[model samples]
Target: MPWLATAVTTVGLLSTGAAHADTFVPLPGGEISRTLGDGTVVTVRLVGESATISPSMGATPVHRNAWVSGRAEVQVAGGIKKGSIQPGYVVGCQVDIAGGGVDGGASGKTDWEGNASGGLTSGGNLSLGPGEATSFVILDRESANDYGDESHSSANSFKGSEASVTWADSTIGLSGCAGYAQARAFVKVKVQTETIRTVVTLWGQPFSLG
Candidate 1:
């Protein structure tokens, strides 16, 4: 299965330019920078997920039927405040640049959910065993203020000093959510309003899980 990370990397980084004349000229180390029509520059930085869970033994009574569920929520920086995100930028399931130097942020939830469900039918005792796991993440980016003083909303959980995941090898957990065997969810944003040309690099990764 092509890890959802790829989708995150592709759509997460440069999906808006996929249709228009916006060509995604790959930058060194999967980085790309481009200026929109207005004169605002947005930089793309693909950070990796950190948290992981190794395949291990789960609570078991060797029962014929058992079930379980797990969930996780990640915290990200930036919100409906100035400097939190590029002025006049919009964010959604897929990051889209609507031209201009503004940073428009989309409103909604910022949590990714996944689960693993199955049944342990042994000895014909009629037992169903289901398990689930969830996690959270924090994405941070550097914004240049060369274009003057800009304001940004602050996210509830965007403030903090946390470690990041460097690679995708970090196993998170199992998924039982229909069509989520390989699930990937995250937040994205687009830059619209700006005064001068500056660079903003997105940075974040899933939190760790034992």
Candidate 2:
């Protein structure tokens, strides 16, 4: 199985030019950028992302499984407000399987609902393990902590300091969620203060995983 980073694939960064929303462009090494309506820019450069599929180690023989993991450095610059009341940009990733897990079709869903950590290299070295969460989820922490950098956010851990964040590897064992699929790392910005109401997001190009 070969890794499909954006640099080598035809599925390059694509975004909407419309003025109503944010812009997204895929970058190399799973990187992506989102420009907000207020001219604020949030960049998320993925150091690496990976996925694994295998028979479950659980005693239950009825299911197989796949685990998806992502890691990246994030930052915010220009037009960012300080001490805003709304939740700031959210940096995270998700998995979209072709087979759709155990159901193997339209009935399958997205989201891995796992715990996330913040740092400079939290998810960069994650690997499939015997014990893992049942689904994928966004990184959630009450404070704004950088991966030892100078970043700050009102509601997320990735505010200041080009913090590193990761959605630790999680399992998707339904038949519909099995097989090869695309994994996407993305960023979202939401600032709802008394003066500005901007919501924008940028999704990095998808990569192959099985």
Q: lDDT tens string, model 2, 1-210?
A: 121121111111222334322222233544556666666666656554554544443424333344444554555566444311111111112333222211211112212111122332212122322222122223322333356544322223222324444443443333332333334444443433335555333444544433
Q: Which candidate is the best by lDDT?
A: 2
Summarize candidate 1's per-residue lDDT along 1-210 as a digit string, tens digits: 111111111011112332322221111122345554554444444432222222222322221111111111222222211112211111111112223111222222322110111221111112112332222222222233458744222122211211122222211222222211212223233322334323244423212111
The local distance difference test score of each candidate is 0.23, 0.34
Model 1's C-alpha root-mean-square deviation from the true structure amounts to 18.5
199, model 1: CA deviation in Å?
A: 14
Candidate 2 accuracy as lDDT: 0.34
Candidate 1 weakest lDDT stretch, 10 residues: 114-123
